[model samples]
Target: MSFIYSISANTVSRRVILSKFFKQKRLYSSKRAIILGIETSCDDTGCAVVDTEGNILGEALHSQHLIHLNNGGIIPPIAQDLHRKNIENVVNAAVKLANLSFNDIDAIATTVKPELPSILFKKFESMYI
Candidate 1:
């Protein structure tokens, strides 16, 4: 019953999040579950929690735009480090804002795409703290 589109940031300009939770096998009743999403491909760290019905529970995002803008370009190492520094807090805040804890998340989703290297993908897949 919660339908909110929320976000938090330190240096991000804008974000447009639209994705659904990955389907999983269910041996029990057809109850809805939640998915947490993390994005840290380029210059921002974004997190969101959504339900099976695609309602956004809560979200938090941190952008390194000013840093990149000041630096004159997007440096991969700097972007990675910034993601490392802020991902934990961002994820935590999103779950908190949703009035839930990590355990409440039935599934997790993150960015893994063409432009990002394996390292970044690994971070999104393995690192949540």
Candidate 2:
């Protein structure tokens, strides 16, 4: 089994610099928000950074399809271990691709629910704030 991670809106902060310098409802407000999305529901691990306007700033992904296929299907423990090992690299690549650091991200969003294991869900949950 390959570990899966999902995107969530936890790492972003809503901070709009409302100043008189350039008023009149900016198209993409500073408060528009930037989100880092991570998805790991099955054999693919994906991460993306997007703005509130639905613009993708950066994205990274890793697929374990070949690994699983060679094994004749995913083994839960194997999948979980793979996810654990690859998540950090995936996330780091996303940040680099976005040309931003963790502080620049407004939030982090990951899928957490019936689709993912509770332990994996909790791992992302702790990244909030």
In terms of lDDT, the best-performing candidate is 1
Q: List model 1 lDDT by residue over 1-82, tens digit each.
A: 1222333454422222222232333345487778887777678888899988989999999888999999999888887788
Residue pairs in collision within model 1: none
List model 2 lDDT by residue over 39-59, tens digit each: 766677788988879999899
lDDT of each: 0.67, 0.65
Query: What lDDT does model 1 reach?
Result: 0.67
Residue runs of model 1 more than 4 Å from their true location after superposition: 1-25, 114-129
In Å, residue 79's CA in model 2 sits off its true spot by: 1.3
Q: Which whole-number lDDT from 0 to 100 does residue 10 have in model 1? A: 49
Per the 3 Å backbone cut-off, how many clashing residue pairs does candidate 2 have?
Answer: 26
Q: What is the clash count for each candidate, in the order shown?
A: 0, 26
Evaluated at residue 53, the lDDT of candidate 2 is 92
How much does candidate 2 score in TM-score?
0.68
